[model samples]
Structure formats: structure tokens, C-alpha cells
Target: MSFLSFSPCCVKGGILPGVPRGDYDTSTLKKVGGYHVNSSDGMIGDGKVALVIFADIFGLQVPNCQILADGFSDELKCHVFVPDYIPNPPPNSAFTQVAKTFPEEYANRPWYISLIEWIKTIFKAWKWIPTFLFQGNQIRLAQAAVDNLITEGYTTIMSIGYCRGATILEYLLSSSSNVIQCAVLCHPEPKPRLYNHINRPTIWNIPDHDTFFKSNEVDILKRIMGKKVKDQGLEFECFVHKDTVHGFANRPTLDHEATKIAFEKVNNDAIEFFKRHLLQ
Candidate 1:
């Protein structure tokens, strides 16, 4: 069972409000009705629409996701659920280290199995669990959350994710028939190898900072787009922020002047895209 069982009463009680405000390693993921699994809640208008903002590997500690959540809640007038899967005070170990620490015998274990083991070590050493195990589980939990929200009277559903979170959301979008009106990704991981399974009105933001956004990166995106990126099907916008790095826009620590300019333009575009695709 999910640690955070999607419950309408939880949303009504306003228990899940905005992302957790603390360091990931030191924070316990707030659970809606079970163990630790923190979440935030807000909406655009009067709570007619809903959005779920999933975060990258660093978990909700990335301030950009928080900024986006605030802006999205305002623009969409829908409750936003930003859940933290990474336990607090993240284990002092890096993902690569955690991945390597598995018993030599478990080296070939399934990715999910290895991830659970990692979470166990992390939770035992500290009060937190590594989000590595939540990789494939976030969307399923998110979908359940949406279903719960729908019972609370939300009609529209939208999802947005950055980096690895976006990659997972893509999988969720492709697999589920949930009423996800539209899905957007910013700096998401490209589909491994050639992905020929895209089927949604998607939009991507590519800034100049990410290494992959360089000339070669554009080629890769183009290759990925291969025929899927069209005016009507999917809109791929590469608005390079003259000079900026990854995690620029919503990341306060890295928010450069260029990031500000880029985000101003992209944020507006995102609102319009969601409005057109999700509400209209």
C-alpha cells in the first residue's frame, strides 16, 4: 500500500499545503494518511482544476519546483500536490554510491528491488528513505491522489515535472487513461534511445545551461522529435537563455538574470499552454 493513501479528507483538512520547506536528507517525506510523505496544496481559481507537480532527484528541496507550484496554483486556480518521496536528511550517500553498495550478489537485481534495498538502508541509518525507490511509484501514487482529488470535486487534471521527474511523468502519461488534460516537462530526461511511443500534447523547455542543450543536444532532441514534433501534435520550444545552466529558472540558488528573463517568458507560455490544452 502507498504510504500516503490518497484521501479526500486530507485535502479538505488542508494538511497537504505547498512543498516541504527543509533539506531533503533531514526531512521525513510526509504521508497523507500513513507514514512520512509530505505534500502541498493550492489551486488557480476556486479549486475547479487540479495539478500535480513532481520534482527531480534532489526531491522537493529544489526551490524551483516550489516556485513553479506557486505560480501554477495561481494561474490554474487548482490545488497542487507536490509530494516528497525522499526522506529527510537524505542519507549521506550519493545515488551512485547507494546503487553500488548493494550486496555483490544483488548486483544484477531488478532496478526496483535494488532501489527498495537502498531505501531500507537509508531509512535504517537515518529517519529518511531515499527517493530512488520511489522512482516508478510516484506516478502511481500521484494518480491515486488525483483520483482522490476528483472525488473532492476537481474536474481537470494536469501534470508537470522537471528532469527525472518529468521522465517518470512521461511514462505515466503514456500508460494511464487518467483524465490528464495535458502534460508538460521542463529539462526532462530524454527517452532512452529512440522513443516511438509519445502520444500527448507535450511541450518542452530547453535552456542553454544543460549540457545536452548544446548543438549536439539539439540534434538529440531533434532525433527524439523525429516526426512527433509538429505544429499540431507536440510543440518543442528551445528558448535558450543566452547564458544559464540547468535548474536556472525555479532554482533560487541558480536564478541568474538570464534565468529570470527566460522564466518570465516560459512561465507565461506554460500558463497559456495549460489553459489551452487543459481547460479549453
Candidate 2:
């Protein structure tokens, strides 16, 4: 999913997606400048704040991410942008090949068929080498998207990343300062080491069994992000959603009760986190 690695967990997480709430409307959105824009034009506030969503590998195509973006815009009455920062997001067919063939998702398939599919998946991964190697391009494209927003008169810019997109956001925020005001990472890709620097207020919406992060790794992220920043008001805090999988927040498994509840809670928490760190 990321430029660094092909995450099987991310592939499996894309199998079954949950439905977005009926009230979260996104009927009029169209791609503009390589991104989808959601806005309310200051219906509730001054509309000076802009939120950027670095979506999962599915990017702009994922319904859950789109709905979540709409929910943020509708709730906050601000501008929200979902940028396609990377190219050739592995298709649903790829996820199907990887997930259905994997034992965790389907145990009833014939061994020979599974083996064939597994081999095919391996070949697919090798083909993805070019995609992962383009992280630099992804960052450049993402940076331009954020910079363009700032140029458009948005005073406060906040961002959230899901899955592989989180990996990119981590690098973006670590390398640049004073760009994003605050952040919420939903099911972020967990790294083994601390980032070079994290200067913005960030919250991690961690799932019980993260697709990318292990328990100890999540603890490590908590420790790294939990450190209090001088005068940032709200510091890094990781909210663990219990009894859920890695993509429970962004690519919900519609049948699971826990997934639904966690999705709502994560969205609400993110909205509140953004509000608390307003530049005004």
C-alpha cells in the first residue's frame, strides 16, 4: 500500500466495506486539481479552516473515506480535500486475489487453487515495486496540494491519514513544520522507530488489532506521540477501538457491530480534536 512496502493487512482490510451514514452527503463533489473537495462555505463558522484527508490505498474511490470527508465538512462547515497523492492504487481485484486466497479470509478454498492464487499474489507484489518506489513523487504531489490550500487563504490546515496514506502523512509532517495545524491518524501505518520530528498535535485512532501496527508498536507510537508539546494544548493521544480490525475506521466491515460503533466514535473524536486545536 505504501511506497516502502506492500501491506497484506491493508489488502485484507479492503475486502468488505461498511456503509456511510445517510446524512453524510457528497452528491456534488468533483475532482479539481487532482483532488476531491468538500465544503460548507462557513455555514457554521468562518470557514477559514481546511482539512486534508490522506486516504487509504483506495484513495478517492473508497466510499468510507468519501463519506468521512463529507461528515467532517458537514459537521465542521469547512473545506475538506481528499487528494490522490499516489498512483495506481491496487485495485479491488488485487485485494480480492490477496484476501480470498489468504487462509484468514477463506479456509474452504481448494489448496491447489489457494496456492495458485498465492503465487499470483506474489507476482502482483513484485509488480508493485515501481509503485512503492514513487514515495518521493507522492510526497511532492501531496505537498503541492497542501501548499495550494494555504495559498487559497485558509489560515488553519489540518490533516488525517488512513492506512498507507498515514505512512505518507507521517513523512510529510516529520519533514515539514508549520504546514498542518493538527492531525488525526486513523489506523495509521506504524513504524518501528520514532519519526525525525513531529511538531504538530496528532491523535492516533488505533484499532484493537491494527492492520499495520502491532500492540507494542502502537504502545511505542503512543509513547512517542503522547509526549507533551509546549503550549500545543492537546498533545498526542492514541484512541484504541476495541474488538475491531485494522481498517475498522476507514474501511468498515459492514456486518460487524463493533466496526460500526468504532467508525462513528473515531469520526466524532477527530472532529473534536480538530476543533480544540484551531488557530484562532
Candidate 3:
């Protein structure tokens, strides 16, 4: 991925710096009165909010990711940026060749590490940096994407991730210059503990799905929330959705009736939170 040069206010030395205080012009929203789409694919709403989406380990090109993006885009009057960080390998991919290099423990971990290991093994097999650099390069690519969008005048940012993508988003929120004004994380894995430190309007939905979710991660989450989180001297609004697994937002895997109810909770709560807390 190509490196980005930050503006003066958002730079310290040569590195991209933290967010600078600047009022956003939220008036120039695209009207959606006559919105039309040949298919229900990627239909964005006419709300005056910009959205940033972090796809699951597979990336945003997938059907499920596009549908979620379309829903948010239409309701938020926003543009969704889905970065293709993972390069898709050919079909009937040689898993054994890649698996030989890494231990069995790494294999059992989340998809991100598995992808990283696969790239490393692929590099060992192919002797090319492209394969090995895919993981790191994709992250930097997402960062560059944030820089580009910030300059293009996006005020509010919301990140939706599942599994390994959730953990990566936590890292991005910590280091990126575009401090998301509003954010949502669905069925996050490695349970985002440090998110309590983030003062921005944020939501964390953890589903009771994989071993990672069932493991001691719940204890970790409790500990994170146990600490005092004071923004404007008020406690943040956080909701925990029990009995739901990870990737609850994906329509294909989701229990339609339950998902509809759950999403109503998320969408209504998030929109209200952003309006009350952020737009104040």
C-alpha cells in the first residue's frame, strides 16, 4: 500500500498525528428522495452521516457485507468504504502447503492470524513478498483509506466488524487519525477491552458464538466495563446481546425474526445515541 502524507494539523514530524478539532460541514448531504437501484445491491440512504465499514476476515466484496453496507448507506445518507485488504487465492487452494509452516495452535486461532500464517507459508513456498505483505499491507491500506475519507469531508465514522476484523478495527481506532465520532462493532472477537477508553459514541455487540466468545473473554469484558468510563462526566450507554453468536448482522446466517429485533435495538439505539451524544 502507498503511504499517505498528513495535513499540517494532523501531523507530528513525518507521521500521521491524532485528530484535530475542526467543525464539520454536515449540510452537503446527497438527497435520496428518488433513490433507485436495479438490484437491492449497495443501496445507500439519504441521511447526513458518513459511514466506514470494516468487513469480516473475508473482506467486503462478499454478498453479506455488501447488503449490510447497503442498509447503512441508505439509512445514514452515507458512503461506505470497504477496503480489499485480503487478496483472494485461486479455488481449491493448497491449504496443506500453507499449513505445513505454522503450528497446529495457530491454525485453531482466529482467521486473521491464520491468514497471516497462510501468507507467510505462501511466501516460503513462492519466495515473494507480495504474499507475506498482504496482511500488513492491507492494514496500511485501510489507514490510507481513512486519511482519504477524512479529507473528503466525512464527519462521523461507524465501524462494523466480525471475528478477526473486529480485533483489527480496535487497533485502527487506537492509532488512526480519523477518530470515529460514532462507531458500532458487531459480535466482536478477542473482545474489545480498551474500547472503554474511547470517548466517542460507540456500541459493542458481543454474541455468544465461538470458543473465543465463550472463553474467559467475558471476564475480560466485565473488567473493562467495571472501570469508570466518564465522557462529559456521564457513563456511556452499552448493551450486551446474550444468546447470539458472532456475525449476527449477516442476513444469510442470522435468524431473520430475531435478527430483525436485534437490529432494531442496534439501529435505533445507535442513531439515537449519535444524535443525542455526538450531534449535541
Candidate 4:
């Protein structure tokens, strides 16, 4: 099986700096059309175009993901829905433990020791097993969410996915579905089987320093997508962020100014892509 199908790297990076816990305002949560969506102050726009944000392993409950959804809603002037496809969200306590201990542990121990500890933190049952078993189900749920949004008067829809969710979105885009007009995938796992099935305009946000996908692997993807786009008359674009790591879009280390800028630029670029494709 390809690393994209079921790799431990798919489950990595559940924890990041500045993710919120219990203090997140539930008032910003509500069912938009038929799916539970998080938007700025729970606001839902009346625009014909809508965005579906397929969240990372942290699911819709993560503050950063919610904030990104809200940001998309405001920036695109479109109704954005973040559905919880992962029924059992990875435990916050496990990530919290890592966040609390990583810095001090890294300072005191060998670099390999800290790396081992970080691996131990993310390689939990909730992260890996459910991802393998329910990836297809996530695709179905995302399609259903988009269908519901269409029923609610959205004439066109676009999707954005992060990490494992990006893999699911790849499936969604490849499937014979017409509800989603275009898609943006961030740090997606490489699935060669589905690449041939993508017929719509798509954008891939590739990080320069991803551990899961090495430079050669990214080059292969670029070659494949580039050839396919030309041969099939499909629109495909890739943005490789320099000085970035995996999961920087949603799970950014905000302390780094470069990471912050990368996130904003990618977010804006995605919105503009949707505006060009979905709104026009």
C-alpha cells in the first residue's frame, strides 16, 4: 500500500502551538443547512458559493481549525461548513501532555530522545486506527455535507482539506461527484490511484520541509499532476511553501513569523482560487 493509503505519518502532528481547549465559544457553533458549521460569530452568508473545510485529525473542535473556517467564511464571503467526520476526535489530553513537556524535554535530553517522545505522543490508537478504517466514510460525509449545502441554496461549492482530511478530500474530488466544483488540499498524502480521477480544477499546497513527502515524492506529484492537467485539459496548480513544515496551514507554529505569513498567503490564495472558479 502507498504511504498515502495508511501511514503513521498521516496521523502525525495532531498537536500544535496555541490550540484552544474548553474555553472555545460554543456560541459560534450551529447547524448550517444540515451540517454543523463554525463561522465568525456563527454567521452564515447568503452567497451562492459555499466552502467545506475537511478538518485535520483534531476535527472541528480544534480552535485553529474553527478559526480557519471562520476566516474562510469572512474572507470569501461564502458559507463555510466544517463537519466532524472523525467521530472520535483524538484526545486533547494526549496532545496537551506533549505541548506541556516537549520544550523542557528537548532541552534536557538528546535530540533523538525528544523525537521519540514526540512520536509516542501522536502515535495513539485514536489517531491511526480510525483514520485507516474510516477514510472512505469521511469522503462520504463530506459529499453529504456539500449536498446539503446545495439544498440550502448554494449553487456552487469548493472544499479545502488538511492532513488526513486532505487524503479524504482527494477521494472526494476523484469520485464521480459533481457537487464540489473545485478543491484545495494542504499537505496531502500521495495516492496515485485517485490522481487519475481528478477532473476539476485543484490546488495542492505542498510544504518544502515535509517529513512525510520528501523532495523526490513531491517532484513525482508535480510531474503527474502537470502531465494530467495538460493531457486532460484540467486545471491544476501547486504552491510549494519554502521554509515550511507539514501541517503549517492549520497547525502553524504562530511564534514563527514565516509560518504565520505562509498560512495567511495560502489561505488567501485558496479563497481567491475559489472566487475565480466557484464565484465566476
Candidate 5:
């Protein structure tokens, strides 16, 4: 079963407090070995470590995603690249307008129409058709970006994925010959099979109130991860943010103090995890 939650609330976009509300600075955007990268100079050491950010469905063009990418570069003092997996991503205005009306529009659909759509979905599923077939293309694009970074002399590569992007990262990690050294998954849509195959150190930032992973689901994942930790001595860390919801890390509900606290805490934890695994 797919772990992805196609909830309207999950897709509803908003900007977090303290984050800038526009595109990344022009100076930060440059070509690195034939790949566009948002780089941060003046790294503390001589290590050639870099972070690849696989953004959520909103894609790399979203201001919140860009802000988070820039924040990671600034915090880690390393080169960060947010590849344009969606070449012609929807603009912010369009996304925001849709997000605002999606719930009401969905509710207003005729019952027969909804039933027909459900039947079509079931038929597609029965035929083994992938719901997010476009993800295959995104994976290839992300791989190219990673390969480009390696060509530019990066020795170690760490990945940070949000939402749908997390599934892509998990696919890479589960592959038999991926070069990703470590990963940080924020509000991931982790498949059950991933727990058994992940070899590298991973930090999972799970929101306690996630619509996709309820308490029982989270317990099952914890048990699976716990077994892996015990049997393989893997460094699979899971941090469940109390009183938090999905998208809290990137687009936190700033009105809530707990969400704000969880956002900062998760960011700090991810930074520390990267330092321990990749920088040291």
C-alpha cells in the first residue's frame, strides 16, 4: 500500500514564520558542472560533502522550498542543490488558488461523479498502474543531479527529502548500488519494504499527528525499524514531533507554538545527524 496521503490539508500550501516569501537570491543560483545549483560558499572544512534536497510536490520553484534549501546551505555551510524535477512547475498563485478551493470543490462534486472517479481509480489500481507514474522521471532527474555533483568533486552526498520526495529518496537508498551516504526524511511517505532494505544512516522526522501515519501505523514502522536496528546495528533514528502535523518541518503552522518549536528542533536534529554521519 502506498503511504502517501493525498489529503487536501496536506497539499494546502502556506509560508512559515521567519522565512522569506520569494525566490532564492540570484547570487546563490549558479551552474556547477553543467547542473544548476544553489550553493553556499565558505564551508568550515576541506570536505567535499554536499546536500541534495528533493522537494515536495510543490517542487523546487516554491518559495518555501527555496527558503528551506537556502537555510540548509547556510546552516550546514555546504553546497545544496534543488534540481528542477518539474520543469514547468505550477506557479505559487495557481497552487494557492487551487489549494484554497480544492476541499470545497471536491465536496461539491455529485455523488455519482465521485463514484465514477473512484471506480476508475480502482480499475487503474487493479491493472497495476502507478498513480504517480511521473515519479519515475523525477528519480532520473535527481540521479542526474547527484551524478553531476559527483563529477564536480563531491566525495560524500547526503539527501534530504520532504513528502513525495521522501519516497524517491527511499527508492535510491533501497537500490543495490546507490551512492547516497545518508538521508534525512521529513514527513516521509515511507513504504513498508524500505525498513528492511535501508543500509545507510537515516534520520526520520515524523510528525505525531501525521494524517498518513496514524498511531498504529507508526507503531508498526517503529517495530520494523527496531528490528533492523537490533539485527543490523543500523543507525535508523525516528523522531516523532509531539502535537505536530504533516508539513510542519517545511511549512509549519506558525500560529501554533508547538509546531514552531518542533520545526526548529527537527532542523537542528537533522543538521546534527548529518554532521555525525557525513562531516565527521
Candidate 6:
């Protein structure tokens, strides 16, 4: 996890692979507990274990995030929630339009076209960029949402986050305030005091070459987490996928075979993770 850097190129992401498939159906989406929930008829889990998906900058509106929420809900047999923590979308604009639908919009686009459009997107989305970058309010909302879930009687809760959501997940993981038991982070740009606070098991799905988290920093994070597992007996694992870039797991371009593999790998790994942790 290239220390989940806040580099200039964080805005310039790579191919987000996979078309929505499996149980990633959107028809299951509904409103529950002040969030967009993926469930059938508003029921969440067996009132036992549940999962929370902290979404990327694309927020809960994008198919990318919805797919994850829905798929995880079905596979894990646990209801999932995507909090509407990012409030008040900006005035309609080209960037907002693309952010809302980049999964389908860029599905077949060539890398060059995607690059150009995204570069343009950065400039066009000036109004929204700051919102994604400064997630102070969102962080509070997400934390409170989890607290509310616990108050509502969910016995076990786990979370997985992508990019911006990863930043917030780290905040949750490090806190002593919640009973959150596990985490899955995809290409997260982790915050400072990196290993100081995480109180539970965490899994990382990161790319080998990504401007977002950097290769050098990945080595450092992996090393520290490995030591924590040994010295503190807390579980931790990381997968540095070869020949991929940042955002590959969450929003892969799918134009390349490696990216497609990366996407599937992430999904499979997360399922196994939750099954092992939550089912036991």
C-alpha cells in the first residue's frame, strides 16, 4: 500500500476492470439505517453479522460501489451498507456525470481516450475534488453510522473500503470506540502513524505499480504489518498483484487480462476473508 500517497496522480487513476456480474445486481439496493443497503426486502443479514462498504470517491451512486455492496451481501450472506456519507452533490457537470457512471462509460474506452477524459475530468471536477479529498465530515458520518448499527443490535460487523474510503476505514480500524472486527482495503492510501492504531485483522489488495500507493511504500507497510502479526498476535495479510495499477480492484478497465484477474482475485480474497473471520 504505497503508503496510500496523496500524489497528484491520485486523480489520474488506471483501468477499473470488470462489468458488474454474479450477485452484483442493483435491484437489491434499498434505503436502510440512513444508508444505501444491498438486501432483499430491507432485511439485513440474519440479525447477526453484517458488512459495511466504505466506497471510493465515486460514492454510492456508481455501479462500481454498488456491485461490491451487492456481491458481498449475497456471497457472504450478510447484508451490506454503503453510507451516504458524502452529502450534497455539486451542481451537475461533466465530471459529476462521469463519476456517476464511469464503469459503463469507460467500459470499452481505449486507454488513451480514458486518460484524456479523466485528465479533463480533473479540471472539470474542481468543485468536487476537494470534497473527496477532505473527508472530515464524511469520516464522522461513517463512524456514527457504524455506531448506530451496533446500537441497532448487529452482533458482528466488518468493513471493506476502496481508495478514499480506505482512508476512513483506517480511522475506524485504529479506533477503540467501535467493535469492528476486521477490514479489507483495496489500494488504500493509508494515513500517517500508519501501524500505530489498528486493533484488528486487516487484509490489503494492492497493485505492484501504482502511483497512488507507490511500490516503495508498499514494502514498508507490509514489513510493519508482518511484524505486528508476529509481536502483537494480530492477524494481517497483503496481496501485491503483479502487472496492475491503483484502482484495479475497485474500478478496473477490464481491457487487459491481468486487470480482469486482479478484479476477480480481490473479490475471491474478500469473500474468503469474511467467511474465515465472520463465520467462525
- Taken over the whole model, the C-alpha lDDT of each candidate is 0.54, 0.66, 0.47, 0.66, 0.66, 0.68
**Which candidate should be chosen as best, given lDDT against the real structure?**
6
Who is ahead in TM-score, 3 or 6? 6
Model 1 has an lDDT value of 0.54
TM-score of each: 0.60, 0.77, 0.58, 0.76, 0.72, 0.75
lDDT of 2 by residue, 1-280 (tens): 1111223233334443334432322322232254444554454346667888887766665565666676677766777777766666665456554442111445566789878988887776667666655677777777777887787788888898887777778877887444887788887777645343776778778777655677888778766555544344447777888777666667665445576567667777888888787655
lDDT of each residue in 1-280, candidate 5, tens digit only: 1111123234334553244322342222232121123334567446487888887766755655566666677667776776666444434443332232111335566778777766655553442334244577667666767777787798889988887677788888887768899998888775787667778888888887676767776777788888888988988888888877667777665446676677778777877787786664
Q: In model 6, which runs have C-alpha deviations exceeding 4 angstroms?
A: 1-45, 89-119
In each prediction, how many residue pairs overlap at the backbone (N, C-alpha, C within less than 3 A)?
28, 1, 7, 0, 0, 10
lDDT of 6 by residue, 1-280 (tens): 2111123233323422234432332221232233444444344346577788887766655656765676676677776777666665433345542442222445676778778878888787777867866878877877877876787788889989887788788888877785788899998885647566776888988777665677777778877787888899988988888877666777665545676677778878888888888854
Using TM-score as the measure, which candidate wins?
2
- lDDT of predicted model 4: 0.66
- Give the runs in model 1 whose Cα sits over 4 Å from its true position: 1-46, 61-64, 86-134, 176-178, 192-195, 211-217, 224-226, 229-240, 252-255
For residues 1-280, could you state the per-residue lDDT of candidate 4 as single tens digits?
Answer: 1101122233334333233221222221232222334334433334566788888776765655655665566666666677666666675556543442111223466778667767887676444566645676666666666666777788778899988778888888888766688899998888877787787898888787775667787777778889977788778888888777777777765445566567777787887788787554
Question: Stretches of candidate 4 above 4 Å error?
Answer: 1-46, 92-112, 115-128, 132-134
**In candidate 3, where is summed lDDT lowest over 10 consecutive residues?**
31-40
State the RMSD for candidate 6.
Answer: 8.3
Candidate 2 accuracy as TM-score: 0.77
